[model samples]
Target: MRYSAGHKLETRERLLQSSALSAKRSGFSTVGVDGLMKAIGLSGAAFYSHFSSKDALFSAIVERELGQSLERLSGQGNEDRERLERCLKQYLSMAHVEQPESGCALPTLGAEIARSDVQVREQAEIWICRLQESWAQILQSESLAWAILSQCVGALVVARMLATPDVQRTVLKSSHEEIARQLAVQRAE
Candidate 1:
C-alpha cells in the first residue's frame, strides 16, 4: 500500500530524528542506513524514498539537530551574562558529559564532520555560525563569544574522552568555573 504525503513526511522525520540521536551516540560515519531504518521500524528500501543518499540524510539530521540545540538554548532566556554562564554550567554538567547520545551534537559530531562530505561540512558551518551568533549576542563581544564556545566544546570533548569519572568531573567543573569567571570579568569590564 502507498503512504500518503503526510505519512511519508512523518516517516522521513522519524528517520531523521532517530538517525540524529544514533549519530550522536555513534559517529555519523559508523551508522549504517539499514540500521537507522531498522531503528525506525521502516524497511531499508524506504530510506531512499525520503533521502537521496546517506549524505543527504546526514545533512537533514544535522539541520534538525542544530535547530533543536538553538531552541533549547533560546529557551534559557536572553540575559546575556546569565545566559553565557548558564550555557557553560549546563554544557559541562556531569549529565551532559556522561550522556553522549542525548547531548549536543557539536562535541559528539565534530570529529566525524571534520572528515565528512562537503555537504555535511557546509551544514556544520551553518550551525557553527548560528551558535556563534547566539553566543555573540549574549556576550556582546565576538572575541569573547568565540572563546567561550571554544572552551566549552574543548572541555566537553576532553571530559568525554577521559576514562575516570573523577577526571571527567574535574574537567567539567574546572572548565565551567573558569568560563564563568571569565564571563563575569567580561561583564564587569
Candidate 2:
C-alpha cells in the first residue's frame, strides 16, 4: 500500500489549499481538524502526518496566502502607476467583495491573525511589511504606502459587512475614489 514519493507532498498541498479556502470563507477558528481533513478527502488521523498541529497549518496558510498576495499586489520589478491603479480597482471591486474565499486573506483573516500567537503574527507581519515595502518603493512614499494598504484592507472589510449589494458597492466606490485622489496628490507633490 505504498504511495509515490510525491504523494505526501501533494496531499499536504491539497490539504493546505482546501483548508485555507475554508478558513477564508468561514472563520479559521470555526472549522475543526476533522472538517478540514474531510474537505481534502483525508481522515482526521492523517492530519498529524502533514502538520504537527492545526496551529502549524494555520501558520503555513498565512505564509502561503500572504506571500501570494504580496506578489499579486506588488507586481514584478516593472510595476507602474497604471498597474497599481488596475490592482486597486480589482481589489475594491464587487467581485472581490463577494468572493472572500478567493480574494486577499487580510480582509477575511486579519482578525484571526491578530488574535493568533506571536509566531503566527510574526509570519503575517513579515509578509505584510514586504507588501508595504514593495508599494513604498513604487510610490516613493512609505507613508502613502501604509495609508493605501490600510485603506484597501479596511474598504474590503467594510464592504463585506454591509447586507445589501448597493451599500457594499458604495463603500467600495467611495474608498476607491478617495484612494485615487490621495494617489494623485502624492504624485503632485
Candidate 3:
C-alpha cells in the first residue's frame, strides 16, 4: 500500500524525533539507520526515502530540537522571571543529567558534533547561536547570556561525568544558584 504525502511526512517526522532521542542516549555515531528504523516500526529501506543521508536527518533533528527550545523560551515574554528560573532549575536538575534521551542535545552530542561532518557541525553552530540569542534577549546582556549558557552546559557535562548522583545534584544546584545570584546582581547594578 502506498502512503500519502502527508503520511510520509508524518512518518519521517516520527523517525527524526525517535532518532534524535536515541542519538542522544547512545552517541549519534552509534545509532545506525537500521536501528532508528526499527525503533520507529519502519523498514530500513524507507529511511533513505525520508532523508538523503544520516547526516541530513541529524541536521533536521537539530533544527527541530532547537526550534522547540526557542519556542519555549519565547513563551516567557519579558515579565516571566520566575518562569525563567524554573526552566533553568529543571534544565540542570538531576533528572535531566541522568536522562540523556530526554535531555538537551547539546551536552549529549557536542563532542560527536565536533568530530562530525561539516553539515552537522554547521547545524549545531546554528542551534547554539539561536540558544544564545534567546538567552541574551532574556538576560539583556550578551556577556551574561554567554556566561549563563556556558555555565549551564558545562555544569551538565560535568555532572553527567561524575561518579555519584549526589555529586551531580550538588554541581547542578550550585551552578544554578550561582547563575541566578549573578543575574540578580547584574539587574541590581
Say which candidate scores most in TM-score: 2
Off by over 4 Å in 1: 74-78
Residue lDDT tens for model 2, 43-107: 99999989999999999999999999988899475657679889999999999999999999999
Candidate 3: tens digits of C-alpha lDDT, residues 43-127: 8998999999988888888777766665664426657566667778888888889897887877888887788789778877887
Over 94-189, each residue of candidate 1 has an lDDT whose tens digit, in order, gives 899888888788899888778888888988888778878887877778888788788988999999999999999999989888887887788799
Top candidate, metric lDDT: 2
Q: Rank the candidates by TM-score, best first.
A: 2, 1, 3
For model 3, give the 10-residue run with minimal summed lDDT.
Answer: 69-78
Count of clashes in candidate 3: 0
Cα distance off (Å), candidate 2, residue 12: 0.2
| Cα lDDT over the full model 3 | 0.83
lDDT of each: 0.83, 0.94, 0.83
TM-score of each: 0.93, 0.97, 0.91
Weakest 10 consecutive residues of candidate 2 by summed lDDT? 75-84
Candidate 3, clashing residue pairs? none
When sorted by lDDT, best at the front, the candidate numbers are 2, 1, 3
